[model samples]
Target chain A: MIQAVVILFSVLAIGGALALLLTRNVLYSAFFLLLTLLGVAALFVLSSADFLAVAQIMIYVGGVLVLIVFGVMLTHKTDPLNRSNQKPNAVLTNHRAWLWPVLLAGSMFAVLFQMLRQGNFVLLNRAAKYQTTVDTIGRQLMAEYLVPFEIAGVLLLVALVGAAYLAMPERN
Target chain B: METSTILIVAALLFSIGLAVVVVKRHAIVVLMGVELMLNAANLNLVAFSQYDPDRLQGQMMTLFVLVVAAAEAAVALAIVLQVYRHYRTVQLDEVNDLNN
Candidate 1:
């Protein structure tokens, strides 16, 4: 049962990711990206990392995707007939471009696969001992990783301010 | 059926992300590609966390990566909006005023 779920989630994630890359329209790509993120979150849950799964959904789906859609809206005027202009002919023209990504990704996967195959990665048994709940993560955040967490918060605040400053209308 | 399957998915996601970044001219599409890449990393982190029980470092790092991705998306989109306002187009090729 667990294996089936893992396979399902993996397919969803990889499929959604392919759709995101293949789509021509930026808006459609963003929507597909949401699906990809959701699928990855499901994968996290399947792996028993519940806290990461919830955080993925909340932060990526809720927050980041929303911002992306907003960016799409702010940048482009909605024209229903502009579909032709949105087609990905430019990207498809250069067949040679695909070569590098294929090679790099293939090599990396090969290396990682060999490493995993050699390593003793006991799955179900080890998952039983880990505490991957939200509370446990929260506790760790406040205890051992407190300083880094605080720094991240400060960084986010700075980013918010910077974004507002950049997007604000210029007044004469 | 196992960790290898998960890794395969992650690799596919990473490659697609690279393609999107390279092929797409729109800044938003590039941003989406970055998001996909980040998701791939998160998948690896969670998968590894499952294998090791003594440390939840991967999960915690995934959380931080999420926060960083959020911040990056927010700031990057704001920059895109600003660029559109200045030039009235988001096409990467046409928006080359800074090319010099």
Candidate 2:
């Protein structure tokens, strides 16, 4: 049952990423990103990282993706009252540069795949088992990883303030 | 799920993200690609954490990564918004004022 879910969500994730790549409209890309994020969240569930899964959905899908869509809408000049001429929603680009990225990413994947096939990961991971990670994670975060956890909080606060400052329009 | 299977999925995601970042012209779309790559790393971390039952280090790292990714997206989008306001376009090729 879990295997089936893993496979399904992985497919959903890969497919959504591919769709986002192929789509020209930024709005469509944002929606496709939604699919990808949700799929990743499900994969987290299958892997038994329940808290991360919930955090992924709440933070990525509920927050960042919405902000992306809003960025798309705000940046574009769309007039709701006028219907005569709508600006292009699709992004324009040079087609010639595409071959290099495909080659680069493809070679990287090929290298990683080869490494995975040859490595001793399977043997080393023999003792690992699936279990709910939330409690363990919480205790560790409050204990061993306390400093980093507090730093993360501080980083988030700084980011919030900076983002607000950067995004706010000039009064003059 | 096999460990190798999850790793392969992460590989696919990372590559697709690289492709998106490379091929997409819009800054926002490139940011999306970056998020994809970040999630790919997070998946790998969680999968490995499943193997090491003792420390749960992988899950901890994934949490930090999530926080960082959110911070990055916020600041990046704000910069992108400001860029659009000044340059009047978001395409990577055309937004080059330094080259001109």
Compare the candidates by TM-score and give the number of the best one.
2
In candidate 2, stretches whose alpha carbon ends up further than 4 angstroms from where it belongs are A78-96, A122-127, B98-100
> Evaluated with DockQ, which candidate comes out highest?
2
Candidates' C-alpha lDDT: 0.77, 0.86
Per residue, candidate 2 scores C-alpha lDDT tens digits across B1-100 of 3567888999999999999999998888899999999999999998888876667899899999999999999999999998888887778777888533
- Residue B90, candidate 1: C-alpha displacement in angstroms: 1.1
Model 1 stretches astray by more than 4 angstroms? A78-132
Q: What is the C-alpha RMSD of each candidate to the true structure, in Å?
A: 4.0, 2.6
Q: Backbone clashes per model, in order?
A: 0, 0
Q: Report the lDDT tens digits of candidate 2 across residue range A55-150.
A: 999999988999888888777764457535555544333322778999999999999889888887654557556688778888999899999999
Task: Write candidate 1's Cα lDDT for B34-82 as tens digits.
Answer: 8888888888887777665545787888888888989898889888898
CAPRI level of candidate 2: medium
Per-model TM against the reference? 0.85, 0.92
Best by lDDT: 2
The candidates' interface RMSDs, in order, read: 3.0, 1.7
